[model samples]
Structure formats: C-alpha cells, structure tokens
Target: MKSTQLTSTVHLDYGLDTLFGRITKSAECQVGLEQVEHDPTRFALRVQPPIPQDLEQAKTVLVKVDGRRLNGIIRHTERLEDQSLKLEVEPE
Candidate 1:
C-alpha cells in the first residue's frame, strides 16, 4: 500500500464540564499521515508521532484530510517502541 505524505493537523477536544457547562479545551498538533486509507464514507489515518501529550485527555479528535475536514474519535492509540504513535480513527 502506498501512503501519502501530507501536512495534517490534529484537533483535540477536552470535555470538561464546569458549573457554566462544558468547558472547551482544545489543542492542535501539526503531524503527518503516514498510512492513510481513504474510502467513500470514512478515512483511516495512521498518524506519525510523536503525538501531542494533550491528546491523551482528548475526547474528540478532528483531522484535516486533503481539503476537507473530517471529524472522528480516537478509537485506539498505541505507542511503538520507536516512540511513534499509531492511531485508529473512524470518521464521523
């Protein structure tokens, strides 16, 4: 499989609820999509680390793929021995 190297940004939303309701905590990281699977309905992005530390607390993750913005949640994340991160995302 061929992978596309592109500049992608990861948006992480921290769901923090306060007396005022949910507090919006967000962080953005400039990363690369190493192994990408694009389908008619969804995209599976294998993010090249090192992923932002803030992502550990992220409830929602949004990625900018191509010229389109795709929103998804982080289904799984693994830390490789090489210190890289592999993320399984399902587009919503």
Candidate 2:
C-alpha cells in the first residue's frame, strides 16, 4: 500500500514482566507515522528510545496520538541501524 509519512508525538503503553510481577510502562516519544492509503487501520510507526524491548511480541500496544486513541497489534518489527524501531501495526 502507498503511504504518506507524518510526524507526531505519542504515548505508548505496554506491559512488562519483571522479577516481581507484570508492570505497565508508559513511554512518551516522537514518532514517524506512515499512514497506509488503502487501509487506514494499518500503518507503520517508527519510534526512538524510552520504548519497551521485545515490543513486537507485545500482545497489544495502546497508542495515543493526534488526539486519538488506538489499540494496535504489531504485525512486524525491525530495528534500524540508527537504533530506531520500525513497526507495522494493525489497529484493532
């Protein structure tokens, strides 16, 4: 699908399992949003640091951006050489 790139700040909420128990972590970061022309519910997001590890395996990602709340499932993930994480997400 064709995509248009845009920039925005977002809050990512995810759960992490620690030695104690599962904990929720919230990260605020700048992200590049690639909106898919054919499918508005599917897009690619690129984010930098303060993000959780093993994010692709996360059950669900709660994204708050552009005054909209989205629950996304990570379809794929790639770690760029610049240390940024690229993820293909499908909103549910």
Candidate 3:
C-alpha cells in the first residue's frame, strides 16, 4: 500500500539497549485519533503499516495531540487485515 503522510507522530522507546532507545523515531504510517475518554485520560490511536517496530513492544509512548505532548502507556494493540494497527493508550 502507498504510504500516506502522518497527521500526528508518536515516539516509542525500543528499550534501553537498542539504538532507537536513545533517539526515538516517528511512526511510518499515518496516525489518527479515534477516541478520547475523560476518566483516567485514555484514548485510541490508529496507525497504518508498516508500523514502527518499537511501538509493538513499547510499554509507553509519547505523542503530540493538539499541540500538547502526552505521555501514555499502551493498553492494547489490535491488528487489522489491511495491515493497520489500532492502539489503545492511557495517559500517565
């Protein structure tokens, strides 16, 4: 599939050992906010493949939404047949 421009970018840590750990990178596919729940500050994020490697294993993620940087943890990850990923996060 053709790559589309990402609306928002997320920076994920691979681990303390990986090269990407020191310098996080943006996701490869477009990112869209699906939903945001008020209680505990949880939300859903949609991303297309190729998904970032670190993202899959990341326990936490850093993202900018509406000009605000949010630090969140991955609650869940759902894989779609079309090679898209749905991520559920809870802000910390």
Candidate 4:
C-alpha cells in the first residue's frame, strides 16, 4: 500500500450534546495526515491551528477530510511547542 502525506483543512467533531447525545462540537482546522505503516485505517495526524485542547487519548472523534467522514478514536496525543497537536488515530 502506498501512503500519502496530505495536509488540508479538516473538521474535528467531538463532544456531545444533551439533546442529540452525539457529536456537537466541531472545529475547522488544518491537519496533516500520514498513513501509519501500511494500514490505511491508521494515521498520524499533525493538527495545526487553531489547535484544540479537548482532544485526548481514547476519545472518539470524527474527522471530515476530502469529503470522507472518518470515525476514529485517538490512541495517543502529543502537544508540540508550535502549539500544534500530534495525534495517533485508529479508525473504528
């Protein structure tokens, strides 16, 4: 499998609403996507500003990228000095 290094504007869907019991908060930001190893469902995400502080490990989040909505869980997170957030996400 071939891996693509892509950086684009993506939507991050997180948090829950009491009324919907589903995703309620969304933020538009630039993100870098690189496939992890040979797995298409796993990715290393380098998220740029505006960086979100709510994202954490084991949190389920939806990322809308290039017209595809990817539902995945954050496996790990790292805070960069540049204020960008690095994340390892695995699609569930």
Candidate 5:
C-alpha cells in the first residue's frame, strides 16, 4: 500500500450561520481574518486586541500536498463535527 497526500479546492460556506455557531468547520478548513489597529491617542483609545482566532468567514482554495493537486472540495466556516466534502479523484 502506498500513502500519498492530496490537494484541491473545496466549495464551502463562511456565511452568517457560522458566526452564530449554527454551522461547523472542518480540521482541514482554515479561517481568514483582518487585523485592525486602534489609536490610543483618541478619546476612546481601544483596540480589538489581537485575537489569535475569531470565527469570521469560511473559504475554499486549491490545496496541494505531497504530490496531489486536488480540486472541487467543500468545507464549513466552523467545526461542528469531524466531516469534510471531497470529490472522487480518479487517476488519469
């Protein structure tokens, strides 16, 4: 038996539902965020404080691993359970 890593793009959702924990994300899935900076000199000197991780939105892209270039994958915004959507990859 041979072991190989795969990669590909997955169609997923990071919609509002995820923000409320209504949806789940997968271990393979990753989250994207934007860093915001606040001026302390302002009257309300406050910042969001760099939060390591914040459930924001979901995204799908081509993932390459080992020697596989997978395509047509899907995932969620948050991890509700251990499940992922992958396409049937056939050897050419």
Candidate 6:
C-alpha cells in the first residue's frame, strides 16, 4: 500500500529541552520508530506500521500524546525499503 503524508501540531506540557531529552532517550528503542525531524513549527515523526496493530490501544495512546486529538484514522503505507506507514495526526 502507498501512503501519503498528513500533518498537524500539538503542545507539550514539558519544556522543549526536557521533552527532547526524553524523546531522544525513547528513540533508542528499535520497534516502530523511524526518524524524528524537528522544524520551526512542528515535529515530524516518521513511523512504521502507520496503523497500530491494536486499534483501541493506539487510539487511546495517541489521544494522550502531547495533548493531541486526531481528526481521523488514516493509514499511509509507504513504498520504501522499510515500507513505512504514516498515520493520522491531530491538533492542527
């Protein structure tokens, strides 16, 4: 499946420095993470398996991410060596 990029932004309770420190630590895990790109306005996350295998768990988890509330459920499958998937983002 081919996937397109969808985007949005969110706010974090933690300070930028602290938040990035924590995220950098978390990125050490080689499960679903692909890359983390930071920009002036927002953070771009490239992840695999765009749709979490468990929809309920994913929905609940995503709802709690940096106060994000996804607008829709989208599956973006990418045609690459890793076959990445980009999912829905909230709080635009």
Worst 10 residues of 6 by lDDT: 22-31
Question: What is the number of residue pairs that collide in model 4?
Answer: 0
lDDT tens digits, residue span 1-92, model 4: 33345556677776543554655567787876666765656876777777765654326667766566777777777788988777778888
User: Model 6 over residues 18-72: C-alpha lDDT tens digits?
Assistant: 4335221111111222222332322223344343333312221122233344232
Model 2 shows how many backbone clashes? 0
User: What is each predicted model's overall lDDT from 0 to 1?
Assistant: 0.55, 0.68, 0.62, 0.68, 0.27, 0.29
Q: Which candidate is the best by TM-score?
A: 4
Candidate 2 lDDT over residue span 1-92, tens digit each: 54334345577886545678766667777776667556677887777765565664554567765566766677777788888787777887
Using alpha carbons, what is the TM-score of model 2? 0.64
Model 5 agreement with the true structure over 1-92: per-residue lDDT tens digits:
12222223222222224445554433333222211224222111011212114323323223333343432222322232333222222112
Residue 88 of model 3: what lDDT?
Answer: 78
User: Across residues 1-92, which tens digit of lDDT does each residue of candidate 1 receive?
Assistant: 34456455666443444577755566665544544445444344555565656555444556665665766665666676866565556666
TM-score of predicted structure 1? 0.56
Candidate 6: C-alpha lDDT: 0.29
Model 1 pairs whose backbones collide: none
TM-score of each candidate structure, all chains considered together: 0.56, 0.64, 0.62, 0.66, 0.22, 0.24
Model 4 scores what on Cα lDDT?
0.68
lDDT of 2: 0.68
Clashing residue pairs found in predicted model 2: none
- Name the TM-score of candidate 5: 0.22
Which of the two, 1 or 4, has more lDDT? 4
> How do the candidates rank by TM-score, highest first?
4, 2, 3, 1, 6, 5
